[model samples]
Target: MDYQLDKSCVYVQDPGPYSEGILDCENIKVEQNTYFAEVSGDEKYLAVYDAYFRLLRDTNPNLSLVKTNESIHDTISIYSAGFDYTGTSKVTTKRAIQYGKEEQANVTLYCSRQEGRIKIYVNIPLEMRFADLGYRYNGSRISTAYVGGSVKAGLYKCSDGTFQTTDGRLSTSLNAAQVIRDGKTYTASAAYEREGTNDILRVKGFYRNEMFLFCTPADFLAQGDIFRMYELESQSEYLMHNGGDRGSQEDSLTAFRYSEPGVFGACHDGSYIVPVRGPLNRFEALTVRVMYYVPGKEAVYYIYAKYVAAPHEIEALCAIDISDTTTAEEKANTITLQTGQTARLEAPPSDSWQAFSKWEVRSGSDLVKLSSNSGTAVTVTALKAGTAQIQAETSYPYTYEDPLTHAERRNWTTDYKTYTLRITSAESGGSSAAPKKGTTLKKGSISYKVTKAKSAVEFAKAPGTAASVSVPDTVKINGITYKVTSIAANALKGNRKVTKVTIGKNVTSIGKNAFNGCKELSKVTLGTGVKKIAASAFQMCPKLKNITVKSTKLTSVGKNAFKGIHTAAKIKVPAKKLKAYKKLLKGKGQGKKVKIVK
Candidate 1:
């Protein structure tokens, strides 16, 4: 037997498996000049006491030994002895015989003032199995048993004295009670035994972080705040119960035993039935160390079970902005877009932890063109007549640390918003309804196009009714005045309501089919500025009529311009211009049926 000290601990080695058993079970006392090993019948068990006796037994010949009446503050049996060696300074000491049941024994020689602290020399019997000071459990957390961080959960064969693999991917077959519900014990797994042997540690509960660790206790009935038992499967590696499984599967420790110092895996692995909410994060950390005792070799092996807790809760939130000449009501309301028109959409401002991720055309993709699916802002073009809805989404990263600097940062949340768009065709609004530029308006029985600059106004389509009409010289719009230019094509076609017509003074010329099919027309008046007339401008006007031309500069007239007019209609002209009017009318095939009268 031998004894040594390092830091605060004392290590003792007892080399023996003798033919005979020694060390009496009954308690024994100590005295001066009397050795503990000589009386105990085995020197190995009392070697540390003998060494202490040799050093101080002679120095304190006058020292007297007294037995203590107080019981040892431990579960193991013990015999306590006190000694007083007061030469120059006050010296006091205590000797203890810590008795272990079949497998272990200890002898301690303690000093009251050694290196300004109490110290002890420990002696123990060592055979085949390994041992330590034993486990210390508490509600706050558990301290690791091994001095080094190496092994986690793995398998070992006692018969062959060999170890299988120390890998993060591990599986176990065991049947054990894992949860405590309403103060009653519950089994967490349907199957909890390997080869009909309970190979798992039945835990009171288990706790874990999203990707950090899975933790429980070494004892079968140890209690925790999360689950009854957690059997870590190789694939998911999450806690399991009879009901279901919970928590994330990602982890940093890929192997049970790593070449690197800190990497570790769970001790046992298997499929688990966990809760939907998964393991609860306590926002703290704890340690659990599992021990395997080999009785044949009298050896004990241990590894660390480290885990981290997650924060209590988390939430994501999103909004959209449109750009154009829209009123507040229009902006809030559904957007109305003409086919072939495009609109701009903007996202809300981005915050440090919150930012826009992308845009999506949730519906009506065929009617609109999204500039791109991903951006803080995008442009949508109306492609066809249809309705489309758009959505904006956000992103929140899981990691809290900055990627570049590795500094801690605030956690993030996400949100989303949506908008609707309506596209319309030109036919629904009438001719020039969807003009890219210019203003189209419906007034009375006609629709007209006024240029952006208000330079001129032209009839865009045939009038809706044929009532007697008169074109104005100028039209006022938005504080701007525009000249009434040439009449648009088919402006007055197929109208029976008109009995008389008068052209505005600013009107330059008549368009084709401008007055076609005006069967009720009886009289016509032209402005002095009229220069040319288009084909079929007055064709099919069957009413007998009097045609008056105020413009002496009329240069050309189109074919059938006056067809179906009264056969004996009188073409009125200014005085002394009868001969010139006759020539202009002759070209329109009105030379024989009409007479120029001034």
Candidate 2:
């Protein structure tokens, strides 16, 4: 007969003879032709039955077949009859056979004959047997171990030395030779591991601006295996001890371990920790090695992890006498200011991983004082006549989870940019080094006149045909730059073609009728330095509807400065000065129907 069996079926052969004697006493009847027997011994055995007694086939062995007293057996059929009365019962050797956490008090044995061989079924519930072991039944038989959940399309291994998924396009090796972080690339260098230590593999990269290393065990790691990390004095020592190329001379007798405080610690996630002596220099590269040792076997494993540090770039913007029209090269390095004058310095807007830490005076601290330094921008007042070095410090923000407590932690890496500031006494007379002024000049479509002080200029005139006018903070004439300080009376008065006017930061005042009767003017942006506006400065501009004032120093507005403008005009001012500017400009130029907003 041809027979097919699955993993769940067990076949046994007859032992041919009985070694132990069989003694049967109480006949507990469960049915007409069936009986229950409790057998105990310490040897391989076989059970057979006669008319009124059962027999054993083997001598003393650690095998027990006990009949349970529970009624659960009523639902199960444990006997099958394809054999004669002298049938054999075979039990396996000493081993663990329980399924899951449940203990069984009874064993039901079923025997059948096929081709002169006996097949025994344990008669355990199929569901319990498959569920306890990691097997799934596919109707016919238990074919494979059941696995739940899903994995990404990549090469992955299970704990039982089996592959869960294999993708030929990806590398099966766990070695990472290159890593990219924050648009910067880091490459690993060739290095040797410690002598006789070769059970673990290492990969290194960057997390934020710090070196990140990961070490994984190459083989199965037992519970008592030792894992540790150490810091060496220098790269040469790390290379020399770790079986690298050796020179002609003998190895150094002294250990190369530094005994100084360092900016190193274990990252809370329990993978790899970095160890270094003192603070790491800018752009410095470091090597890390993880060691694993088996106590009784005297086997050692080492993993070499290395990473190169890249510095963060910091950009600075100087707003002193510089405007929107200034080129980046002109505002690159140094800042110039007068004594008792304040200038605003700003760092470029921060990205997702970057943040402004603080403003610091690295040198010549007495020359300048930081009045506001909380945010990305700071206001510095030139206090003395000297050059000062101001540094704008920034950092990379990082967050990680703690291994023990599972809490999140935050950290930062430091970076900075320095600028030179030159301050001169305001009372000093004009010097030859100062830009020459006192001459009328034209730049683009706007005209400017140098002030008598030789240090500043004022807006003079513009063509009536020009539809837009922008008063710049500084004008360059004959290679000398002069700050535009004010707008002369009627600078653009009655110019119907001018529809918009932008006042620069250096402009302190607007002269009488400076922009009066410009019928087409609809929008005006006043700079932060304006202090006063003369009468009729912006009056009779019927189309003026949008006005934005950034001047916190504004103190006065002349009569009819904004009269007869658009009835739906909206004047936006700084929030801190909302109430004051509203009362100051009310009924002067801004009508009752106009909306004032902060």
Candidate 3:
């Protein structure tokens, strides 16, 4: 019944059976599900809705229709959908869960109003499935529908297609229960998903930035204060539920809002679920995105408070400036601030630290901050006095002494993965910007490099750990990378107390768990246009010890390949594969401790 209408906007062309991807089901609880897509005869037909499920046959080779003038607002279906070529596809977006392959997905929803901030972009096209749902269910710990846990529960799949049982029949014939949950109608945080498929991280069309905190209703909610909901997932950190928060994702098209002091909401639509306190029960179900707590405006800066000036000499530059504002409109962003006399020690003693290089402003508020143990160029001085657009972040002073012996147990350190870039004050004029850098940080300008394997992760603006920068041009101290060439694969795979890894000399290949969980990695090196080493790639590198395979183009070495190694750390093979590295070091028992070296 392909129909089309422009004025009131009504266009439909076969919108069902689309979602052939996504399933982190974050442990699954099996309540409601929605990767999205579908609409037929439900009666309310004014028209103008489109969403399909299943994509990737080379996606968009002129499939066209990636339009984004946006204006749909919300829709949910995915009670279940699957085709599995191996599986993987959840991470619906807010940026985190990523692993693809289940197939078909068209999720088309839109809303517009650029420049002021509501610029949402969700175009699902998948690939890359690491799959690791397993956690346990039925037996309990909850996470069914399937994640490997209790071998996947309830067996989702609905929307009337069929599948959802306590008696059982659909738990993982790929799972069903496509979308159907009210359990009585959960709002803010009912704390569902003892395991899998409860609300596949639901929330259809929402926005948020709410703020308020007498603390505990799971600690209020701070930041620009926004929380809208159709879906939100996070089992615990504090707690999170979904379905209604009414402040949708933001950038303001239908409405815009943000209250101060105790903070409130209304950035646009609705949907929020923030909370992740104390590993929640050992990462309970895991699905967090609440970035920065808005208690007062999150102004923490104390990376060693001042102990950062030892050998601290700053001077690194890169600039570009413009004003009178308006070319196509939307060109104003520069950060670097410092200027004051504020002190709080217990962690800033390299005599407080000092360094410089870079600042180009005019977005307004003249991006201020010039001192307090060397203002260290922050947020490009809230720009407004015109003339900014500078770039001089070649500053240096990287000291380390937290060898991560359990990393204080767990205040923070999954070997690190924090990234924030909320620099406000956008060259003033018609945008009025300024007052960000803490909406949970992360917006642009990030380039990293770390060779002899890798390390260029970002987001450590105010400390609490998360900084391993240096590699844009490559000079990775000890573990090598003097000239550099490759090592992207998760570069450094979480430096869990990095244990010796060096691989430079015009490198060639190492990506994919480039080092995966270091756990005091045990020395690694494989120069010479390397080749293939993927899969668990080095698994959790438990005291890796030694493995200098110098690939002249090696071939194959994946799968628990070197589980919990450390046969005195020395297995450098390459003498023409030395009988396939002496039968893979006697099937990893360590064949005569393999060693060919030259």
Off by over 4 Å in 2: 1-438
lDDT score, candidate 1: 0.43
Q: Judge candidate 3 at residue 441 and give its lDDT.
A: 15
**lDDT tens readout by residue for model 3, 1-598:** 1112222221111111121111111211211232222222322221212222222212222222322232232442212222212123333322111113232433333223323222112222232111112212111121212111111222233475332333342121111111111111111211111111111111211112221111112223332232211012221100111223322322121121111111111111123223222222111221112222323222100000001222111110001111111211111122222122111111112322343333322223243332332233343222222322323232434444557663432221111111112232333221333322111112222323321123332221222123322223233222222344554556566666555555544555455565666676666766665555554556667577767776656654555556556555567676777777565444533334534454
User: What TM-score would every model get versus the actual structure?
Assistant: 0.28, 0.28, 0.20
Which tens-of-lDDT digit does each residue in 379-446 have in candidate 1?
77878787788887776644477899999887666666566776676445422223222344333334
TM-score computed on alpha carbons, candidate 2: 0.28
Query: Each candidate: what lDDT?
Result: 0.43, 0.47, 0.29
Candidate no. 3 TM-score: 0.20
lDDT of 2 by residue, 228-323 (tens): 112122222222334233311212111122111111222212222333222331222222211222333322222222223323311100001101
Every candidate's CA RMSD: 37.7, 29.9, 25.4
Colliding pairs, model 2: 42-60, 42-61, 42-62, 43-60, 43-61, 43-62, 198-301, 562-589
Error of 3 at 227 (Å): 28
**CA lDDT, candidate 2, residue 504:** 97
Off by over 4 Å in 3: 1-489, 493-512, 516-598
